[model samples]
Target: MPSKPLTTYVTHQPMTAVQVLEKAAEIVAERYFHGDVFCSAKATKDFLTFKMGGYEREVFAVMLLDSQHSMIEFRELFFGSIDAASVYPREVVKVGLEVNAAAIILAHNHPSGVPEPSQSDKRITSQLKDALALVDIRVLDHIVVGETCVSFAERGLI
Candidate 1:
């Protein structure tokens, strides 16, 4: 009989956003985060929007950061429904100002398991990037999360 294949299991404790990105930054040549890159990127913006109960169901989020391409704060801004949520660029800037963030990353999830960006998603990111740019805030990346994830910066969407 063939020898039983070795079984290995690895358990990971929950990690904070900062912790997650720190690890990714170390390995990936480009910035990467676990969930919605838009929401993650946006969390790095001055303010964060938490929306609940329309689409994504229940998922808390934050925007990971880097200082002039270095790591800064991992700002967890809100909790809300995925399908519908309010995103205020002014408020985001306000939060970015409060945090003194130089750049931003955005991330959010799709509970329906599709990571594609909707037209609204692209429009909102463009609007936010334009809005934040006026205030000297750089929009680094926007990510969408589902069974898999996608990045706007990686796709040249940002």
Candidate 2:
């Protein structure tokens, strides 16, 4: 969140080193994206899909944004097995606070390439929306990215 130089790993845990590097690299690269307003839902979807499209496993991520919907940081927060990712509201709120994010966009990949929100996805989106709202951080959308992206917002599920 803070504008510090990013290095790959800080913990001595048993996680995939390759994944760690990939996530860190994404964060670093995001710092240089074009300074365009991301309020357009269509553009937001395209951007999120671009970010998560190629992942083999499910990756839950967020794009931290300022009140004007400009980018602050992009994070790949949770990695999971082929079908699922365990999303934690607390950690998301922590990062939101860390970046001083005024709003957030949630996205995840479905390796099955279906691009549909499962029931679990809907449930978690509701939970996260409530949790973040408590901190006055609006949720712009919850996008499921696979072969394509499905927006809970467009469908009014958020």
Top candidate when judged by lDDT against the true structure: 2
Model 2, span 1-158: residue lDDT tens: 78988788767777575665456556544553445546466666666665677688999999898887788888999999999999999999999999999999999999999998999999999999999999999998999988878988889997
Q: What are the lDDT scores of the predictions, listed in order?
A: 0.61, 0.84
Q: Estimate each model's TM-score.
A: 0.60, 0.77
What's the distance in Å from true for residue 57, model 1?
2.2
Ten consecutive residues with minimal summed lDDT in candidate 1? 45-54
Candidate 2 Cα deviation (angstroms), residue 53: 0.6
The lDDT of model 1 is 0.61
Task: Using TM-score, give the best candidate's number.
Answer: 2
Residue clash pairs of candidate 2? none
Question: What is the lDDT for 80 in model 2?
Answer: 100
RMSD of each: 11.2, 10.2
TM-score for candidate 2, residues paired by index: 0.77
What digit string (tens of lDDT, one per residue) describes model 1 on residues 1-158?
89999999999889866555555444432344333343444333222221211234634343534454444555445555746455667777787777777787776666777778889879978988999898788888877766666778878998
